[model samples]
Target: MAPGKLVLATHNPGKVVELAELLGPHGLEVVSAGSLGLPEPDETETTFIGNARLKALAAATASGLPAISDDSGLCVDGLGGAPGIYSARWAGPGKDFAVAMARVNDELGDKSRTAHFICALCVAWPDGHSEVVEGRVDGTLVWPPRGGNGFGYDPMFLMDGQAQTYGEMTRAEKEADNHRARAFRQLVALLPARPA
Candidate 1:
């Protein structure tokens, strides 16, 4: 069956709002996992797809509704992807992106700042059906964080050709090229259109 107003397994306001804005236009009513009272599950998986699928499947089973979940993090080439799936906990809870970004830079220290923001999204149905899609945006991580338009590592994440970091870009611009949006588009592509 086609998806009918599925829940996105996340409570992040920024993430949820953006997904809502993007999916709303397509007539896909997006619901947050918080709205459905589903708790965040432990991301014991090693890969982005594993974590994303874990949350999506858990939410789908808990709510009995189709669910989608995304896991994304900065993967620094020089640091050998030090923070891959551990981006959030890099700073040790409190979800401190500042400290996390700093640690990432320190780890790279004088080396190349080349990195990519990878997003993995998974959609799951209560009947045990699931699909995963992923996207990435290559960029350089700067020493001092810049811009106030975005949260997390946005201030430090500078796109190759762009002069500004993700935080420096306007919301519309970030939404257009963000890893999550990129992955979401791919997930949408894999989805079958509504039935007549």
Candidate 2:
């Protein structure tokens, strides 16, 4: 086949940029599902795999193009994985990640403060081919949040073994050590090599 041109199922540009970096040197043409006017999946699935696949398959089938999608969330140890799939809508629509983060801080309030960021990456091909990978970066949650870099849970997540929180870290630092990037690297490694 021709060099792969992937359509990321999500409309989020931040994720689109991150995905491009993770995809690497093959220089594959990356497109967004929003460009195709595709509606985002309902995300009705209970698990990350289900949600990620829903988006990837929908975009791939709609555009007749290979597609990539991610379903990621912050899981709090005390909450027993609550707000997992609902992380995006925890504070209701219009996606107030800031509010959501605050809510988490409030809910956990004075307990064993452990948390993790989980990422599910799904790739779907027009011919119905597909793949899914998962990655997690475990850490403890902090109160009042910190830093000003990352969006959504970044301010509170003290990445494992690191002194600075995710929000405190730069974009490059986040990508190099983030859950999404780890899972993406696995998926990218699986991409077929281009013809010379």
User: Model 2 TM-score?
Assistant: 0.93
TM-score of each: 0.93, 0.93
The candidate that wins on lDDT is: 1
**RMSD, candidate 1, Å:** 1.9
lDDT of 1 by residue, 1-196 (tens): 2535878898877778877787787766789999888899999999999999999999989988888888888898998886889887896768778888889878787888899899999988887788899999999998789888866678899977888899889989898878988898898888775331
Query: By TM-score, how accurate is candidate 1?
Result: 0.93
Provide the lDDT at 108 for model 2.
Answer: 81
Candidate 1: residue pairs that collide: none
User: Candidate 2 lDDT, tens digit per residue, 1-196?
Assistant: 2366878899877788888777655566888888878998788888998899989999988998888899999899898887788887896777777789888878887767888899999988877778899999999988878999877778889988999999999999999979998898787777564231
Instruction: Looking at model 2, report the run of 10 residues with the lowest lDDT sum.
Output: 187-196
Collision count of model 2: 0
- In candidate 1, residue 95 scores what lDDT? 79
